[model samples]
Structures are given as C-alpha cells and as structure tokens.
Target: MTDAPDQIPEPEEGAAADSAEHPESLGDDGEFGGVEEFDADARDAADAVYAALLERVGEGAPRPRLEPTRRAVELLGDPHRSAPVIHLTGTNGKTSTSRMIESLLRASGLRTGLLTSPHLERFTERIRIDGESVRDEVLARNWEEIEPFIAIVDAELEGAGESPLTFFETFTVLAFACFADAPVDVMVLEVGMGGEWDSTNVADGQVAVITPIDLDHQSRLGNDVVEIARTKSGIIKPSASVVSARQQDDVLKVLENAADLTESTLAVEDDAFAVISTTVAVGGQLVSIRGLAGSYHDIALPLFGSHQAQNAAVAVAAVEAFIGSGSVRLADEVVETGLGAVTSPGRLQIVGSGPTVIVDAAHNPHGAGSLVASLGEAFDFDEVVIVLGVLADKDATGIVDVLAGLDARFIVTNPGSDRAADTDRVAGIVATRVGADRVTVIERLDDALDEARDWATEGEKRAVVVTGSVVLVGDAIAIAADRGWNAR
Candidate 1:
C-alpha cells in the first residue's frame, strides 16, 4: 500500500459509535435490542457520514480540476495508489462494463474493488469491495477516520476562496480509502461524467476503458461528438492499454491521437474485438464475441441488449489488457462463469412480474435508443406501457422521439427527485411526439406504475417499462419489492 504523507493517524479517538440524535440510534431502546441494535448502529453511522457528504456541492456539478481530490488523498496517504486501476468513462455503459470487468477479475482469483457512480439506491452502491457493497460500518468508520483530514483541506480551500470538495469528490476520496483498507488486488473505477478532471482520474489507470461515447452532458462536456470523445480520452495514461468501443470516424481520430500522444496501445471494437452475434434465451441472451486474444463462443450473459453484449466484449478486452496485455486468452470456464455472474441492477432489469415491470436507467437519447431497441429484440410484448420520467437537464424531446414510434403507451411522471422534470412538461413533450391520447399524465411514479400495471394486466402479452432516470428505476424496484412482486 502507498504510504500516507507523514503517517496519517487513525480516526479521531473516542468518537461515539452511535450518537443519540441518530434516527436509527433512537430505535436502540428496548424495542430494538441485540442484533437489531447492532444493525441500527451500522445504519446510523453510515447515514451520519452520508448526511455530512451531502452538505457539499451536488454530484452533477463537475469540478474544473482534480486538485481538491488529489490533495485529500495525498493527506490521507494516497490510498488509490495501492491498487492498479481500470478506469472507464463514456456517455453510457460505464457501470455495466465496470461491473463485468470486476466479475471477470474476481473469477480469475483476484479480490476486486469497483467504484461506480449515480447509484440506483444506496450510496454504498457507489463503492464495492470484492463484489459486495462495503458494509455500512466499514464505510462509516473510514469516513470517520478521514473526516478530520477532509476538514483541514476544506479550511485550506475556503482560505483561498475556493469551494470545498463536492459530493462526488468526497465520495471518491472515501472509495479510495475503503478500497485501500480492503487491500484489493485491483480496482475498476467509472468516472462520474467527463474524464479529464473527474475526481477518479486522480489515479492513473493501468487499463483505460472507453465505452461507446455519445453526445450527453453537452453543457459540461462539449456539444460535438469528437469534442466529447476528446474529453473522455483523458483517461488514457502513458503506456496504458486503451480498449475502446466502436466509435465515429472523428471520435476514433481523437482517441487515436490521445493513444499516440501517450504512447499507449489501443484496441478498438470491430477491429480488435467485437460481439459477432447474440440470441435471446430464457433468462437473458447468448453471445459470441471476438476478443483481442481469442474468440469467446456461446457465452451466456444474463443481461438484455446487444449493447450489453458489446459491453461484455469491452470488459473482456479490458481484463485481458490488465491481466495479460491483450495477448493471452482467459480460460473458457472463467470467461463463461464471469460473464454469467454479472448483474447490472437497473439496466433493463425486471423488477416485478404479473405486469412484467422492467426498469432501465436510460437518461439520454442514445441510451434511450438502445433501451428501445433492446426491448424490441428481447421481449414479445403485445402492448407495452412506458412509465417515463426524466431529469430537468436531460434531453426530454430526444427521449420522447425515440419512444414515439414504439407500440407503447406513455405515462409521464416525476421520479421523486428535485431534479426531475415536471410531469406536465414531460407530458407536453410526449404529447407533441406521440399524440396526447397515447400519453397519460401522472404526478407520482408509484401511481403511474399502478396505472401501467392495470393497463398491462388488462390484456394478454402486455408489459410495463419504467425508465428515463435512475431515480425512477430505483423507485420502481422499491415499490415492486414492497408490494411483494416477484422480479422475473
């Protein structure tokens, strides 16, 4: 492990394990004793840390540079330098690709740490050590140890009239600290947004993975596809192995230029590796992929979409780059088991039955297009009802346009997020794209979902798709589970 500067000490001594004001701690009365008390303590501690981090700037706001994160980690002894990193960034597919890569590495007998962003449910979903979300106690304890150091940095930045570290930056710091404490063999990191100054970029990745780049986050990243690709290309470190998905001509040029400048070896989809075919199966789909070193055939990836197949191909190449320099074939069993074990929580995930409720976190047009295509290819629904909710800053028109041509009814609602676009505004957009008669306006996601289920249950071969934002998908999952609906 890389040493912290001046031997960073442990958490402040004598800090309360369970504070009185904590909601969970309050339940620690006789009503909740023994294991329940222990569990409450864990939850309380984790929430305490989360509440503190949420006080900073929001995750959507990108910091201009990595200085704050760099300094925070530096003061804490640079925990990120402890493990080699596989850094991933792009408009979409980053989380799924990162998860696949982590599974593959773990199957090969390496303890893996995976750090992803915009988690669907719990904040702990953002950091996983050895394939499981870090325990609440561990996450809170790590934060407790680092809180003082973070405050010191915050004071320094405030003295200089600079903003304190944002939510994502602090989470990045905590992830590094947690991963180092776990002493993982390798870590897979997904950038929050554009790559150049992303807090996760503070660590030089040994294998930089770029999934299909698209025009999303145009306000923060540039409008042009090539320009967005250029910003994402920042993760390619000198001599690092670069694995990229198939890209547009201009995007390819930008990536090629970055690889050349960094003297990195580049492997691109359709050229070096690609998903040749995918056939829908019982649970998911069977795919055949041509990887960099060898061809993987008859691989069953339990995820929807040809895009996921593509993501699997990219993940294999990245793992090859990290473990074998893209020259050696992973064992067939290892490849099969690893790919099969992968689970992308909210990407075309089926969270309930009866109505066959499916949820996907497709916030942008490109992702929406992919989701629509996958739905067409994967399911045999006679009629589909879509529960749509989008963030205020998203391309709502583009999303509506993509789904307009589908044989589906639209239920526009909010995802229960402050950033969620108003239901009336979303309905107006949907109405413009696909006549208002086809669009149903609902204020709450749960009510919208109920309406969708009623519509689905009314006929044979009907289904429901909850989408447009990760928050909506999370809500759908919670609602389904609470209602005792079996996630098919």
Candidate 2:
C-alpha cells in the first residue's frame, strides 16, 4: 500500500521458477527482491500524515484541504512524473486484473510496482513496489517530513472555508508519495471507486484498463450500466491507449466513443483482442487470447471460474497494447509467468482439503452468476454450504436466486459494519426461495462459518463457499488467518 511504499517484486511462483531456471541471476548484484528490508509495524507516519491530511481537506483551491494533494505532489517535486503507469478501473475484477499485470511485467525481467485497494489484511497491501510492500518505517518518515507543510496547507484551506478532503482522497496523495519515493519502473493502479473523481485519476496513465462494467455503487456512480461506465471511463487519458474487457454493446460504445473523443486508441474484447479459447482444466482454467495487435497461445491461469479467463484476456491485451505503444515489449515468457502467478483472495479461493472452503466477493447478482458458473465447472460437491453476508445496498434476493440451483444451505451472518446486511433479512429471502428448514441466520461470522463446517456430511464432502459482501469475505479472510483456516 502507499503506506509502506517499499519496492518489492511480487512473491510469484513463476518469478521463483524463472530464477531457478537461470540461477545466475540469483546473486547479490542480480535482480533483487522489490523491497530490501524494513519494519512493518511503523504506521505512525501514515497515522500522522492522515491526521494532517484531515485538517485541510475542505477548503478551496490552493488551500490545504483537497488541494494539498497537488501541493504535496509539488513538494515531492512531482515524483509520479517519472513513472509510467497502467491504471485499472471498473466495478469488478480491478484488483485481480491489476495483480496479473504486475506479475506479468515482473516476469519480463523489469522491476514492477503494484498499487491496489481495499486490502483484506493490511494497509500496506495497497502500495507495493518491485515485490514487497513499502516499509511502515518509510511511511512514518514521510508523515513526519510532510507534517509542517500539511499544517501550512490546513491554514490556507481554513482561511478559504472549504470542506475537508475525504479519507480516500488523502490516502491517494500518500500513495503517490510512496510510489514516487520507491522509484518504480512501472505501476499498476486500481481505482478506489468512480473513476472520474477518484484520486488515482490524477495520474496520467500510460494505459487505461476497464474491466467488466456493472452496477455496484449506484449511490455515487449511477443506477445503470451506461452511467456507471461513463464514470469508470474517466481514467482514460487523451494521449494514452485504452483496453476493455467484453461488455454489453451500449456500455462498450460509451467507452469507445470516449476514446475516440479523446483521440486515444481503443481496444475492446472480441473487437480488437478477445478470448479465443477457454476451458475448465484439472487445476484451473486453460485460456487463449487474440490480441488486437498480436496473439497469445494457451496461457495457463491457475485461477478457477470463467470470469478469471476473461480477466486474463484483458490483462494480456493490456500488456500487448501497452508495449505496442512503442514503449515496452513484453516477452512471451513474461506473459505466461504473470498469468500463472496471480492470486486474489476470496475470489473463488479454495481453502482446505477435507471439506473444501471457497470464498468470493460476489456481493451482487452479476458477480454471483460468475461464482456459480465457475463452481459448476470446477467442482463436484453434493452439497454447497454457503456462508454469506451482504451489505445494505446490495440486491440480496437477486444474488440469492442466482445461486439457488445448487443443493445449498444458507448460513447468514453480519460482520460488524454499519452497512452490513441483516442476517435475519437475508434468511427471509432464503427461506422463501429455498425453504425455512435450510436457512439459519447467525449474527456472528465465526459462528456461521462453524455452522457451515459442521454441515459437512461424511462420505459426501460438503464445501463451504463464503460470499456476498467484501466486508464479509474480508472478515472471513481475517478469521481464516487467525485460526490457521487459510493453510488448508
């Protein structure tokens, strides 16, 4: 995360294999781990910087509020100017897609940087340079260094009487400082929310990546696909190229039109680049991509679900277009390594062997459909025990119906969050659709998970799939870590 801001080479299996293949590069002067060495405990600076950032957030231009972003950048001498980046935006698959790109780039023998969001475990997960998370010590040092200037910005903003910067906004500035200081070769950025006003949009990316556009944050982005796509497409720069995954024609047209208006090159799946072949494999998915400008053969991505195949196509297309822009040339080995090395938690992530455990962030109908489709092709479970929690904004019934076909027993729980969906409300939906006897509403997530585990019948291995809200799955991941549930 921007908080740690240390250079790190992603600890990818492919990269490790590459080193083993060429042992000569494993020396002291050879390709180093992205992050050298640092303490992870020192978030004091991030806390301090965040405190200072909170003060000047609301005032007008030139004030410390939102404008301190620019002031801080200026203070840092505009470090982002030095690094070329590929920024990812969309409703779903941003984090997975970005990580895939980072691994791919690292396989090419070039240093890589990964900047994602909504970290499941730690804040440092957001800003990773080379391969390791930025050290917390570095973050604290920057906060201390920036304090006096932050105070100046706060004073100026207070004089102007403007609203303060939001939490996400201040974090955006801190991320830039972390990345700039790391001096990464290239950065993979995933947007926080709507692309237009999102902090990541401030950077002029070398390429803009748009994943499957859908409706999620209707309160901010919009109520429909077109309006939502419009906001997410804001990350596209005038001089940069744009890469998009498969989309409904109307939504695709909006992005295509935007690219045309900006005089930027546009490539869409099935139009420029596409997934030529896909199949469920012994381990994961076997995929093929036809890049608009080139073609990639069978790329083995060990991530289950059909959605992952699509995400892989987009990542490949992005790297192709990014390199085709006459800047970087991604080697075939690099592309293969990247696709094979990616891992996104709770997105059909399977944990344990006895009675398998799979977790996904399928908070809406669209994502739920993909999860179901992926599970249908990948496993043979006689009974599906679903540990789910949804947010207030999600379509709980719609999502429930999407996975209703399976031999499912619903265990609903609410992680302690203001926006978490009520377990009783969700149980009602399950009761009406499936049956009252099959539904159990449990308030505590840990209790619900235990209930799901208990539902496993002997001789017929029952798997637990934790889904619904990110907050729910995030908590599940945390619990899994605490109890050693992840190792299985």
Candidate 3:
C-alpha cells in the first residue's frame, strides 16, 4: 500500500497565480468554500458531483483492487487515519450490524461516522455522520476538494495502461475524506464486498466485527463456505479485538486460523457473546443479549427477526470490544437506549399497514430462511403474497426451497437491476417448488406490488413481503414512499 499523503497538495500554477491576483477566488478557507447565493446553485453542484461519480464507474460491477483506492487516499493526506475504526464484514447482516454499532457509539457521546453500502434510496445514504445522512452541500464540497487528487491518480493509472478506479473504490475515498472533515471520534465501516481486498480495508480497525458468514457471494468470494470465510476473516488485524456471530464448524475453523495468525483476541458467538432470549413486541422485538462486557436485559430493538436479535448481540459485543477492549462493561442505560433507537431500513422493514407490506434484502438462501423464520415469529398472517426478484447470479432454487413451506403465493418480477434474473426464470423455479398455480409472473415490480396488495386485501390475515435482492428492496422502498406508506 502507498504511504499516506504528507499534506494536501497546493493549487495548480495558474490557480495559484489567479488567486494571488483575485483574493475573492481563494475564499477564507482557500478551498472553494463561499456563501451560496441561492439553493439552486448548491443543488445543481451536488447533482454534477453525483453525475461525475456515476460516470467514472457504475456500482453494479466493481474491480476488486485496492491499489487504486490506496493511491487515491495517499494523495489526499490519508484522512482515513483521523478516527478509530470499527470494521465489519460478513455475508449477511453487515449493514444492519453496522447501523447498530454506529448507534451504540453515538449514544456513548462520541461524534460517529458510518459508511455502509447498497443504499436503499439515495447515494447519500451510504455516508452518514452522527446518525444522519451527510448533506448534499457536504458531499459536493468534499468532491470539489478531493477531485483534483483523484484525477492525478486516474491519469497515473491510465498512463500505466490500467483502468481508472471503480465506483466503490472512489466512494471509499470520499467517505474517508468526509469523515475526517467531520472530525469524528469513531468510524464504523461496513465492507462493500469481501474484506481483504475491499477498498475500505485500507483502514486498520481497532476492532473487527463479523456477523454470521454464509454462502451468499460464492461467485466472487468462493464456491465453498470455508473459502468465503477465509476471505472475510482478513478484516481481523493483528492484536485487534474480534467479535463474531455464531458460525458453522467449517467457517469457525477458518476464522480461528485467521485470529491465530494475527494474534487477535477472538470472541465467538454463544461463547463470548450471545442472545439470551428474544420476545416479539409491538413495533419490533425485545431481546436480551449477553455482551462481552455484561448482560443487557430487555433491550428494545426496533427491528424484527431472530437474525436481528443475533445482530444486536454481535453489535453490543463489538461496541463493548471497542469501548474497553472487552474488559469493561457499558452502562445498562446506554446499551438499552442505543439498541432501542436502532432502525434497519430494509431488513424485515414494514413499510405500510392494512394488508401490511414488508421489504427485506435477503438475496440468498441463508438470508431467505431467516426472513421466513422471522415472518413466522413476528407476524401472524393467515396467508401471504411474496413479490420476489432475484439477481441472475443468485441461487434462485435454493431461495425458493427455503420459502416454499410458507403459506404464501409467489409473484416473480424484475428488480430494476441489469443482473436481475428474468421473471420467467424465477417463476419457473417458484413453480417447481410451490406448484405452477401458486406462482404469478409480473415483469415489473410496481405491477407485482399492485397484484400482491390485491391478494393481501382479499384474506382476513394476509400480508405482502418483497425480497430476494437489495435492488428490489430499494425499488420497493421508493415506490412505497411515493405512495405515502410510512416506514415502521
């Protein structure tokens, strides 16, 4: 990896001379910060910045190389080192776990920065500071200052006959810069993909959190669970405190080896930390978690599912690992408050009432099983209609098998992603498992939702669930919001 930049670069020769001649161009900060005379100008500038980022590389395909991100951040004075980092990685529950960790740290009276991936609605949702999405002005301003350094690296890579940085690599640099500019005390970074080569891995975390590694990204990670676990275990740094969720035997062996090599303190779920009990409640669930420090009882997690209960357990342990290196226990009130206020947007998130509509980002069999279990535990629906859209590379058959036992009808559709499996393909899979008569094919998600809503309204205790891909969950969320469905 390239060494961190010694200092922010000086202006170009012409700009320096122009600044000397015209004092107003320099501004007080000397970095393009002046009073915006109108809101429209700021909005237009933000739009331009977002467009420029999208133009460089699309999010769907990312080249897994850290050299470009390393070079880019090196030229920006290595802002990633400004705060202590809590790095998180796993096949499932990474985003939800990251959100929980951020909430816990923020409740501890620290200014926190959070960077997570696959935003449900806006790109701004990826970078959050102090529990809120970063403002458009802040994103635009950071892009203005960081663009020149990125351009330098882009030219160098192209000159060497290599492609420019991918979308996620560049965004990683932006997140680091924004967090450093905010001057946060702690930063919680969730990996965009695998851990070792992910751009966000440039920062050595003080604590590493792994949440239930599974067989989701087999195409990119590996075909087997063991190999995927090995790839994810790379986030655990030497002497770092590691908090991991309960893993299978083969996966656990891989993580143990990684911890041994790194000389890290590893805390496995059901050993060092675990969820004692979870009782379904109104709005969400009440979970009692045995943390690394102490036991937190009856903590209100404003999200559904047993997987979420486990996620809460891991988040508490990660926070405990961060706060006192797993030596000191957090105050009960602090832990209670932090978890009570947590909200995971699309993970078993109910967006509407009256034939309740739920959306979850469960793209694989493991996650799909969790969704089915959670639905059984949390909701008492006599019948259900599921709007399912899966990516082309996913295990459509495995996912359908997991949910086939549920008393539900399937509506297969497109998730607005180029990689989405064809509606007919998914419908065939659903039909093979649950019978052809129980399956419906609606190519568009909006139309699928309309049909599901009609089905849900026909029965006494019926509901609708949208799942299979993050892209579909994002689209469903936007559609629900547009139709005035309040997210709970």
Q: How big is the positional error of residue 48 in model 2, measured in Å on the Cα after superposition?
A: 7.2
Which number leads on lDDT?
1
lDDT of 1 at 47: 86
For candidate 2, the lDDT comes to: 0.72
lDDT of each: 0.85, 0.72, 0.84
Backbone clashes under 3 angstroms, per model:
1, 32, 0
lDDT, model 1: 0.85
Which of the predicted structures, 1 or 2, would earn the higher lDDT when compared with the native?
1
Choose 2 or 3, whichever is better by lDDT: 3
Tens digits of per-residue lDDT, candidate 2, 1-488, equal 01122222343543433221121222234234432333334455555554655455321122212255566566667765668889999878888888778877776655776778775555666766665555556566755665565556556656788444455656666677667676678888898887876767778888999999887777777889999999888888887889888888989999988898888988878877778877666557667777655666767777787788788888877887776662344566777777866667668877655667788988888899889988877777878889888888788988999878775988888956677777888899988888999889889989888878777745486789999887778778777767776443
Candidate order by lDDT, decreasing, is 1, 3, 2
Candidate 3 lDDT over 1-488, as tens digits, reads 11121222232343212111121232245243232233566567777877888887776666767888988888999998999999999989999999889888877988899999988776777887776666567778999899999889889999999989878888999999999998789999999888988989999999999988888768788889998998889898889999999999999999999999999999999999899988777767778888887898877777788899999999999999999989789998778767876768889988777779999999999999999998888877888889999999899999999989795899999999878898898899899888999998999889999999988888898999999999999999879978976643
Query: Per-residue lDDT of 188-303 in model 1, one digit per residue for the tens?
Result: 99999899989999999999999989888899889889889988999999999999988889999999999999999999999999988787776678889899899999787878
- In angstroms, the error of model 2 at 284 is 1.9
Taking all chains together, each candidate's TM-score versus the true structure is 0.92, 0.86, 0.91
